[model samples]
Target: MTSAQICIMIAIIVYLIGMIYIGFRCSKKNNSTDDFYLGGRKLGPFVTAMSAEASDMSSWLLMGLPGVAYLTGISDAGWTAIGLAAGTYINWLIVAKRIRRYTHTCNNSITIPSFFSNRYRDEKKMLQVIAAIFIVIFFIPYTASGFAACGKLFSSLFGVKYLTAMIISAIVIVAYTTLGGFLAASTTDFIQSIIMSVALIVVLIFGVETAGGIGAVIHNASELPGYLSMTLSYDVNTGKAAPYSALTIVSTAAWGLGYFGMPHILLRFMAIEDEKKLKLSRRVATIWVVISLFVAVFIGVIGYTMSKVGALEMLTGSNSETIIVKISALLSQHGVIFALLAGVILAGILASTMSTSDSQLLAASSAVSSDILGAFRKDSSNKNGSMAAARITLLVISVVAAFIARNPDSSVFAIVSFAWAGFGAAFGPVVLFSLFWKRTNKWGALAGMVCGGSMVFIWKYLIRPLGGIWNIYELLPAFLIACAAIVIVSLLTPKPSKEIEEEFDRVAQMK
Candidate 1:
């Protein structure tokens, strides 16, 4: 291999080794199911904040968002980023503290499903089963998207086969997650978050210089129809800017709604060592998110400028997702040291993928082992058994996700979006109601989950295809429907028991 290739490989290998070492270090802490699943509620503010956002952003931040800007221009990606930033802030402000206190109040529930089950005191365990089932169903595809991104990254960079690269990525993620569980995942995620932010800023700065500076980049993009407009997109066929309707903008912004229901993110809120520290966490997370997102979007704009000026070849379709990788590869042409830095940036892609996948895998495993299987076992003190079950489930789910990722042609953005909608619509309304609405009974919670989850499929497949007004994203409509179902159903049913009402009031008043 060339010196440049060797440098890149060594850098990546070092990053991977560091992650494995963290897993080993944290493995000793996994003495109980609580420790494995929720890190025993001991994460500090910065780790909680950075790890949550890192897992939330995933490879889509680097690959998918840039690809959209590279292909369609600023409208789609910019609005989506705005929506996510709003969601992140809102979720931290409203949901973080309440959920943290409520989970502790409600039998110290560790997983989302268990929290729901404990919150409503569901004797039948129906809520737990349903929530677990939904997690597995949605998270498989979500995890697969990360694996698919790894395949794309390795194949484009190292000339490795897609399947082989994907398998390697999957194995490493499974190793760390299975070994250290929540603590390991969160710690590694914090490190990855830093890497991701640095990579975005560094690549953007260099990419702009390579594209002949900011003025030239803007001028080149301005030449493309609707390339800079938030209310329009470029129509390649007609070679003109096409109007981006208000409905589309609203639909795209609805992505924020998904933050409410994401299991992995919610777990971070629950795991934070102190609720007061969340304020600090929120500020740190938001600042990082804003900076990182701005740089990521600009990287795409820079890629377009580079392509337009013949500095880089234009890519289309799924291949367009490689624009960031292409830009990083170009940095290698400068020198060995630059090539090594490029490898670190490339490792940032892996960092994004692994950080998210490990969280997803861990969440899915907890849903299965802690929520589903543990509910069935009469003996609840089998900590070792539960830990084993969790590891086994992680392995099984990772294998399934890898198999799904073997398609080699999946769009990372599309796949992540569908699963995002599923979690958002299905659980978002239910989670909000459970925390804030004192009258929200088990019946209402169950109804909300069922309605919200079902509506996503119905709207996406049946109604969305009809176009026109129905073209709005499924998450918004489904979210509304789910909220309505919960309120209407709760009013129709008997009021929650006095004990449940008192608990809600206590949590509401919690500091």
Candidate 2:
């Protein structure tokens, strides 16, 4: 094997070792459901912030979005970066503190769906059921996206079959998650986040320097038609579509909105020791996001430049997803240290995938246990049962995620983006209205959930094929319609009862 190939293999081994070490360390803390799932609700500001951001960014941050920028150029990137940034910022500012306070008031609910069920007491079971369904459905695509990254990375580096890579990634993730639960997941996420951030920065610096610096890279890129344009007008090579416009970029970036309702991410805020720590968490999380995203985007830009200038291309047995790996290999050819650095880049991708995938599996399990099962039972004596349920749920969800990730049909970017829109559309509006609106009744909230979620499923899968004037992404339309349904239905229905009002007020009063 080539030295570059050897470097990648070593990097993968180092990452796996680090993950195992962290998992072992956190295993002692996994003594209870709270410790396992919410880190005993006592995580410090840095761990809380970094773990949340790392989980939120996922493989898509490293692979999918950057891949798009590499293939499509900077024009398409503007919308994605802007929209995603806006959504993430607003989610942090709006929902972070409120959900932190509200979840604590509502019996200190440990899961996203549970928070909803507890918030709107009248629809406890229904909310939990719908939530579980949505979690399982949307989560598959998200989890699959992460798995796809693993598949691509392993296939590129080790000549493993894609399916085998998927399974390997799945097993490693499930091992840590089942053994350590959320504490394991979050603690490792913090470590993985550091690795990812450092790797990105290092790769970005070297990649730009090696590619004749930023000026030459931009100049070469600008030679492509509309490469520097804010709007895109190119279609896929098949000639079946138009180039994405500037609006497409915005819509793509608005992806950050999905964070508001993401179960795994919001759980971080709830688990912080107190509301006061939220300020620190927010600052730390945002900075991590900004720096990491900047580096990821830069990596893609550099990759595209190197590819265009004859530094890399499709090999006899390789493909697009392997481009980053190949580019790293090319860097390795420059020096043994550069080859080692390439391994770091590969590990960065692994870190992003594992961090996000572990959190997703845990969140899915939490929904099944704390939200779905716990809602139907009134006896608080079932804590042990709930914990057992969560563990089982983790296993089941991981298996399902691994299975779907092995499927041959889905595209990496599309699957991830679809699930993201599903989460944003289905829960973003409902969560926002529930927190801020006084008149948001159970029925209205339920309506919002059904309409928003159904709209995404329909538009994304059903309506796209029938194809007429519909070019808008499902999230935009679903979010708008769901918000409208909440407002209109809430106005028609009775306001929240006095007790519910008191609960809301009590949550609000918790600093």
Candidate 3:
């Protein structure tokens, strides 16, 4: 095998060993369902923040976002990155403390579905079933995206078929997650977050230096059509630059709006110990996100500049997963240190994908076992049975997601965005209204979720079948419709019982 191949194989083996050992260590702490699902809710701010960010960012930060920046331009990078940063920061600030406090008061919800069932007093199993279904439905495509990323990485490194690579990826995820649960996943995410930060920063610095600096990059970019334009990339087919507008930039920036509703992400708030730590968690998580995103964008910019300078294209080709491989090849011309940096980059990619995928599995499992199954076995005696069902649910989800990964329709980054938008539109409005508004009844929550989620799927599948509507994003339409549905439905339905309204107020008032 080539030296690069050897390095990649060695790196993968070492990373896997570390992850497995960590999983075994974490399993020792798994004495109860809470411990398994939430790491005992004793996590400090640093671990909580980093773990949440790691789970949220995933391979999209390394692959899709960067690839878009590279293939498109710096303008696309700036808008999307800035938008995500702002949205995430607001989510951490606005939702973190409130959710953490309310989940505890609402009987220490272990999952998002549990939160809904309790919040709306969904005694009829309505919210519970709906929430669980949406979690499963939207999460399948989301989990598939992460698996696709791992598959792409494996094929690039090992010259293996995508199916074989996908199976291998699934095995690694299941092995660590099925054995260790959240503790194992969180520990590895913490370690991986550090690896990702260091590797990307090193690359950003080295790439810019090699490319002659930011001034040179901007100057080179300026001379190219639509390269420096923040509006939109020129459509070669139309042969005209699309008019740049504020609406375009705002829509791109709104990518961050999806943060509030992502099931895998909000579970972090529920896992943290108390509301007091939220301040520190927010600071740490925001810093990690900003730094990591900046590094990824920098790599894309530098990668494109290198290609413009007659370097081979790294972000494209049959082995697109090896975009970092291309960067490594370029840097290795310098010496052994650069070679080691390449190893770090590979580890970062693995870490990001694993962290994200494991959390998704956890969310799906919890939703089914605790919400859907628990709804049927209403007797309190079934708690153990419910938890056992959760474990079984995890296995099924992992297998199904792995299977789907074998036949990904698009890049991991693209699939993830669709999932993110679905979750955001469907759940974000519901959660926000439930917490802050007293009038949000079970019907309103159900309507909001159905309308938002259905609209997303319609835009994805149906809207395209008819002549395409407008250029507006699907999430924008779905989100607006969901908000309207919630307000209209809640007003139309009987007001929630006065007792339920008081209970919501009490939960909202918790420390």
Candidate 4:
């Protein structure tokens, strides 16, 4: 490796060592499955807010969002960012406190599937089984996207074989996560959020300066037809503006709906040290998300300017996702110190990937171990036994995710979008109805999950291919269908038992 490469690598190694150390330190606290999965509901307000958003953003913030902006101009990426920002704020405002209280009230449920099963008193474990299956199915690909991002980071930076870099990165992530569990994940996530913020700021400033300042960046963007317009998308092939309809904007903004069903993010709400402190978390999370998203989208504009001025090569297709990496690589060439700074910027990418991947692994493992397998076993109450099962399940899930991520050609944004749609459709409506509608029972929840999840596949593969108005995002249709199913199924079925209704009232009435 060259001197710059060596410096950058050294900086990354130091960051990884710190993360692993935090993991090792936190591992001692996980004496039971509750601690492992929910951090014993002991997260402070700042940690809760930062960890939740950090895990939610993932590598998509650094790679996928900017890639879209770089490829199609701000219209596509901007609307998606707006949807996500609105979703993040609303999820925290509406869902965080209630779900935290409700999950705790429901037999102190530790996982989303368990929360559903417990809320409805589902003795048959149908919710657990179906929800667990869905978690495994959807989350594997979500987690795989992170692994793919890491692989892309390594492959592009050091010219290593993609699979080899991916496996090594996976091992590092799995090591810290398996050792420390939820508390570790949350603690590291808080730190990673800071790193992510720093990385974004560093890159945005560096990129703008290299592109001949903010004015130049804006000028370059304005020169491209429809590139700066929120209502029109730039068509790269035709080199012209394409019509962006109202329906398309709505479909793209539907990304916000995904927050309701995000198990990992919800776990942060549930894990807070005190429900009263969620107000602080909400404000912290909302402000950070809004600012970070704006910076990420603007970076794409700067990247295009850099390309125009010959500071970087023109990147197309999946390669556009590496625009941030290209900027960091340029920063590295300035000298050893700048190279080290570039490494820190690159570490931010890893932080984004690892933060989300750890939470995802924990959620998927909890579904399999605590909700699925634990329901069948008489010794489910055994803390050590549950802990062992959860850890083993985590390992198994990581292996599966790594395998799924083996293809180097996969697009990080595409995989995340599909999985996001799956979770949003399958669980979002059910969560809303269950929390707000006291009459919703097991039957409704079950129907909603199956209908919503199935509809995602049907829409994406079957209906969306029909083109024109049918080209709507799968999440929009699936989420609506799921909500409709929940309302119809709940109304048609018998009302929830008095006991369930009383508990719902108890949670709803909480200050």
Model 2, span 329-437: residue lDDT tens: 7777876777888888888889988899999888778777766776676875766676677788888887877777786445766776788788888888888988888
RMSD of 2: 2.6
Write down the lDDT of every candidate, Cα atoms only: 0.92, 0.77, 0.78, 0.92
Question: In model 1, which regions exceed 4 Å deviation?
Answer: none
Q: Model 1: which ten-residue window has the lowest total lDDT? A: 315-324
List candidate 2 segments past 4 Å from native: 233-250, 314-319, 378-382, 466-469
Q: Which model, 1 or 4, shows the larger lDDT? A: 4
> Over the stretch 358-424, how does candidate 4's per-residue lDDT look in tens digits?
9999999998988888788876667787888889999999999999899998767778899999999
lDDT-based ranking: 4, 1, 3, 2
Tens digit per residue, CA lDDT, model 1, 1-511:
7788888899999999999999999999989989999999999999999999999999999988998888888999899999999999999999999999999999999999999999999988999999999999889889999998888788877888999998998888888888999999999999999999878977888899989999999999999899899999987668799999998999999999999999999999999998999999999999988888877888889999999888899888767777888888888778988999989899998999899999999989888888888778899877777788889989999999999999888767787899999999999999999999999999999999999999999999999999989998899999999999999999999989999999999999876
Native-referenced Cα lDDT, model 3: 0.78
Q: Write candidate 3's Cα lDDT for 100-191 as tens digits.
A: 87777777887777888888777787887888899898887788878888887777666888888888888888778877888777778888
Residue pairs with backbone overlap in model 4: none
Give all TM-scores, in the order shown.
0.99, 0.93, 0.94, 0.99
Q: In terms of TM-score, which candidate is stronger, 2 or 4?
A: 4
Identify the runs in model 4 with alpha carbons over 4 angstroms from their true place.
none
Off by over 4 Å in 3: 234-240, 314-322, 333-335, 379-384, 408-410, 464-469
